[model samples]
Target: MIVFDLECRRGQHRFEGWFRSSEDFARQEELGLLTCPNCGSADIGKALMAPHVGRKGNQMPVHAPSVPPPAAAPAPTTLPAPAPAAVAAPAVSSTPLPPEAMALMHKLARMQAEALKSSRFVGSSFADDARAMHYGEREAETIHGQTTIEEARELLDEGIAVAPLPFPVVPPEQAN
Candidate 1:
């Protein structure tokens, strides 16, 4: 399975679309079967994505040398931020983001924490609580917790509203 970052041309909204293969994605798009999940618009296209070329079974990854090359420029003062979890760690020179970008990331994390302040921590019960609320078996309220990706997908398939946070959230007890 492969996932592509898809964007709606009309709405400019981005979402992930999972497909069996690149050809599958192209076929769906050609048939107008690929619509923006956000706005339900048929005008959609694959967004620019970082290369995720698969490695051959016996191929090994190449690493960059620690010593600077003769043509290399002077090193910058700042260090690169750690790679996002989705990608493999780099083995070569990495250009770090500017201070403004780092500050924006911190601000975003703070905002997310504030938004989830009142949400209950359900831990392993996340799927159960969400399911209960969706079926009207229990009153709906704010909740945040951990559950497998499979469970989250199942919830969405069942038409239950559930979202994964952009940043990893620490449990309340862990925070305290």
Candidate 2:
């Protein structure tokens, strides 16, 4: 599976999309299957990403200096209180979502829950089951299950309809 950082042209919203290959991504885009989860926009495109090139196998690993560095002076026993502005500022790692976005996410989660109510969990046999239904070997029924990206791509190639859930589903056996 390959993951691409995708952006919605309409809202400039960025999200990750996993595909079996570049061709699979192109096929989905051409078929208008790609959409922005945040804005519901169909104008999705790959966002610029930095390549993750690893070091050559023959390259030697860098080692730290064996000698310890000189010790620094001790910190003061007591420090001045932080300013009110600093205390009010949000942390770099914990940006809060806007109220509207939070509401939309909640609504989406509810919708997914409602849809899953009628769908049966087929576990890891999703591809086989879907193929069986599509080829008339089995009766048609709603099913949701875990399958690899390659399996999903194969199913799509075979004209079997399958889609990823917006939110991950806990398998019934694993659910609390």
Top candidate, metric TM-score? 2
- lDDT per residue for candidate 1 within 90-115, as digits (tens), equals 23648898999899999989988898
TM-score of each: 0.46, 0.48
In candidate 1, clashing pairs total 0
Query: Which number leads on lDDT?
Result: 2
lDDT of all predictions: 0.81, 0.83
- Give the alpha carbon lDDT tens digit for every residue of 90-146 in model 2: 236587899999999999999999999999999999999999999999999999999
Prediction 1 TM-score vs. true? 0.46
RMSD of each: 14.7, 15.0
